[model samples]
Target chain A: MVEITIISGKGGTGKTSLTAAFAHLASNHVICDLDVDAPDLHLILKPENEYLEEFFSGHEAIIDQNLCSSCGECLERCKYNAIKETPEGLMVDLLACEGCKVCVHFCPVGAIEFPMRRCGQWYLSKTRFGPLVHAQLFPGEENSGLLVSLLRKQARGMAEKENYNLILSDGAPGIGCPVISSLSGTDLAVAVTEPTPSGSHDLERVVNLCEHFKIPVGVIINKFDINLDQVKKIENFCQDHGLSLVGKLPYDHAFTEAMVQAKTITEYQSGDLAEEIGRIWARIEALAQLKKAA
Target chain B: MIIALASGKGGTGKTTVCASLVRIWDKPVQAVDLDVEEPNLALYLKPELSGRLISEMEIPVSDQEKCTACGACSEICQFKAITVLGEYLLTFPEMCHGCGGCLAVCPEGALSLGARELGEVLWGQAGEIDFLMGRLRVGEAMSPPLMRDVKKRLDSSRDVIIDAPPGTSCPAINAVKDADVIVLVTEPTPFGFYDLKLAREAFTPIGKPMGVVMNRTGFGDAGAYDYCRATGLPILLEIPYDRRVAEKYSQGEVIADALPEFRGRFIELAARIRELAAGDLKEVSNG
Candidate 1:
């Protein structure tokens, strides 16, 4: 099977749109959205829920106030500053707690209880395109990287069970935890970026991260016509770094218009932009094939 | 007052709004780039960095000599960063959360503290603005620690504008949690509106007054506006979808610097934020 993950270091650079378009064009594939915290692909794909599972990871400390001796040992030993002496007596701030279990171990009275935190939920769903695996991490929750990994594993299992040949995933923004987990084992990491300076800078960082993980990378400059000069600079950088310049898409408003209707650009219209996306997908498929052969 | 410009989605103009606000503010203010993973505020602000410090976190390291194969350290570690095999102990520093639980649990006193490089904290000046930012080390999974490092330089005496990372997750929360007020910059689209609701839900518990700045106003629908009205998140500013602004932003030019008209709008935005913050504070005092 060939696995390709679409990622952009900077947010709002059309990763989900392009991934959805690719999913529409590709056959015998499973789609996955790894942007758990702020997922947008579901809005476009409109997946129908098939199975839902709660994701529990890590632990949070809860003080049993009734059994507490009020010794303040948990507060002093807690490095995260999560335990606070509030008006209702000592309390644990759920947001601040790192779930290290230090309080539970160090409490002389054993008043601290460490319980698994329900971080979020993952879903298996069916879209018009194919099977999809997605997740939603609770707001302000951590462990997004772990959640991404879990989704990717589920996607792989789905693809293998159905004998599918491809797995297309939309990754989170930034060169951080979730992005890392999404791109690590993929066959090709497609870095979708814009011609702007922020996009260029972030693309470089994310590409560097892909290189660190030894994953092959292909660059796609969306909205290339916005600034021709910036596009040229990005092209030169790609050449110098020996990265593949997969494709360049012009500035288009159909992306937003189609999104307004909850449709992928390809499904919304058969215009030049959709055609260009098809061509880009062709190029990415060629690269994926090449990687597989090697 | 500390004003944080954040978004539920990436590339929603958090840095753009932050850079412009710092330019039009009438007084010397601190501009902090809390998006350490992909910091872009310095690109627009052009800060001449005056100081740099390496940000590091402590992880436990074990000495083999005094180590008994007891599994207390591994048992207490919630992150599974450390594992004790039959005769050897393995440590994965990247997975470590630096909570020091392993060290505290080791009865043989074989574990010691070792510093792991997180990133770099830089402080400088962008004309009259005091600039500070953090750059996370490449491949580093954690960001909240580095964000905390950058926030250590926050000059509370001066007005602060924080450019927060996008999303409604832990890193975004860590950046804006302490701000007196938050300006959620979002485009007017389905994706933008959906994530805006999530961001609002995430940040509401912080109890800080927040408003919305509608960007790319001409395009997309009114979902964001309707949601804002229903939730009482005042619409603070509406930057139209102008090609000139896009071009200037593409070139890394601050909108307030390149366009005369935007300077007035940004100045007005700063004023409106101040009034909102003051009003919230007054209500808090009365309550």
Candidate 2:
């Protein structure tokens, strides 16, 4: 199976909207939302969750007040500032806890108890396009990369078991841990970006990341008409780097309107924008196929 | 006082707002770009390089000669950064979280702290605005540490404006923490509205008052406005979608710099932010 991840180094460049539109075009594909922190694909796809699983990763120090020495050794030894000396006793701030287990190991009174922290939940859901594996990380929680890896693994497993040929993923913004986890082992990555300076800079960074991982990338310039001069610069950069400029989508209100309606651009309207997206998907497929043939 | 501009969704004009706010404010403001992964504040501000700070983290190195490979060090590692075999041990520096747990638990005193470069901080100046940006090393997973390093440049005497990274995760938290007030910049779309809620939930725990700036006012649905009104989040400013703004931003120009008309809006935003922050300060002093 081939996994094509749509990623933007910067956020709010229409990554999820484009992914949903592609989901409409690519039938029989397992969709995965790797943006566990703030997932929005479900808002568009409206997935009906079929299976839910609690994801437990990392650890948090739970102070046992009963063991109380009030010695404050754990508080002194904690580097994360997770242990706070309350009037009642030493309290652990789970949000600030890094799960380093330093307090648990060095507690002079052995008052610290370590437990596996439940960070978030992942789900296997059914959408109109196909089965989707997505997840949500609770507020003030870490381990985003771990959750993204879990979702991608589940998506790949479902794809193989169901004999689906494609696994399309929507990756989080920025070239951070979660984005790296999503990029791993993917066959092709579509870097959806805009024509702004930050957009061009971030696109190059994400493309460099893909290059570092030896993953082939295709560029999609969203809102390309917003700045044609910047578009020319992006085009030149793609040419210099030998990256494929797979698509250039114009600025359209339909994308946001479609999102408000909880529908993909292809599903919400039948116009030039939809037609352009269709052509963009065709180019991405052709590029992926070309890589396979080579 | 320190104010932060953030949006859970990227490209919602956090950097633009930060640059514009710094330009319009008459005081010497510290414009900190805490989006270490892909910092763009320097791009807009055109800062002149003044200083640099290198941030490093400690990774564990095992001493084979002094050791009985009891696997104690590996056992205590939460990140699985170290693996101990019967005769040997291996360390993955990239996987290390620099927690120093393994060094503490080494029974034979065989594990020692070794330094690894996490990232660096660049401090510069754009006219009167002090610009500080953290840059994470490419392929590095850790960013919060670098963010903390960048924040070391915080001069409390000067007004500070932090441009936080997108997403309501540890990185974003690290950037916006300790700010007196936070300004959430977002467009009026379903995605924006949803992520704005997430951002609110994440920062609400910081116990700081926040307001919203609806960017691209005419571009999307009014979901963001509804969310702000329902949550009682003050609308600090609304920047309508204009091709000129987009064009100027594409050319690495700050909005207030390119369009003098937007300076009044930014000035008003700064005043409102100060007004809100003063109330928070009063409550802090009272309590």
lDDT of each: 0.91, 0.87
lDDT by residue (tens digit), candidate 2, A1-294: 788999999887889999999999996799999988889999999999989999999888899999968888777776667788888788998777899888888887888889899998999999989898999898768789999999988988888888999999998778888899999888999999999888998998899899999999899999898888899999999999889999999888888889889999999999989999999999999888788778
Candidate 1: tens digits of C-alpha lDDT, residues B1-287: 89999999998888889999999999879999999999999999999999999999999988989988799999999888999999899899988999999998899999999989999999999888999999999999888888878888899889999999999889999999999999999989999999999999999999998988888888999899889878878888889888888789999999999998888888878877887898742221100
**lDDT of model 2 at position B273:** 86
The window of 10 residues in a row where model 2 chain B has the poorest summed lDDT is B278-287
> lDDT tens string, model 1, A1-294?
999999999998888989999999999999999999899999999999999999998889999989888889888888777888988789999998999998899998889888899999999999999999999999999989899999999999988988999999998889998999999878999999998889999999999999899999999999888899999999999999889999998878898999999999999999888888899999999999999999
Provide TM-scores for the models: 0.98, 0.96
lDDT of 1 at A58: 85
Q: Pick the candidate with the highest DockQ.
A: 1
lDDT of 2 at A150: 92
Model 1 ranges off by over 4 Å = B280-287
Q: TM-score of chain A, model 1?
A: 0.99
Candidate 2 global Cα RMSD: 2.9
CA displacement after TM-score superposition, residue A129 of candidate 1 (Å): 0.8
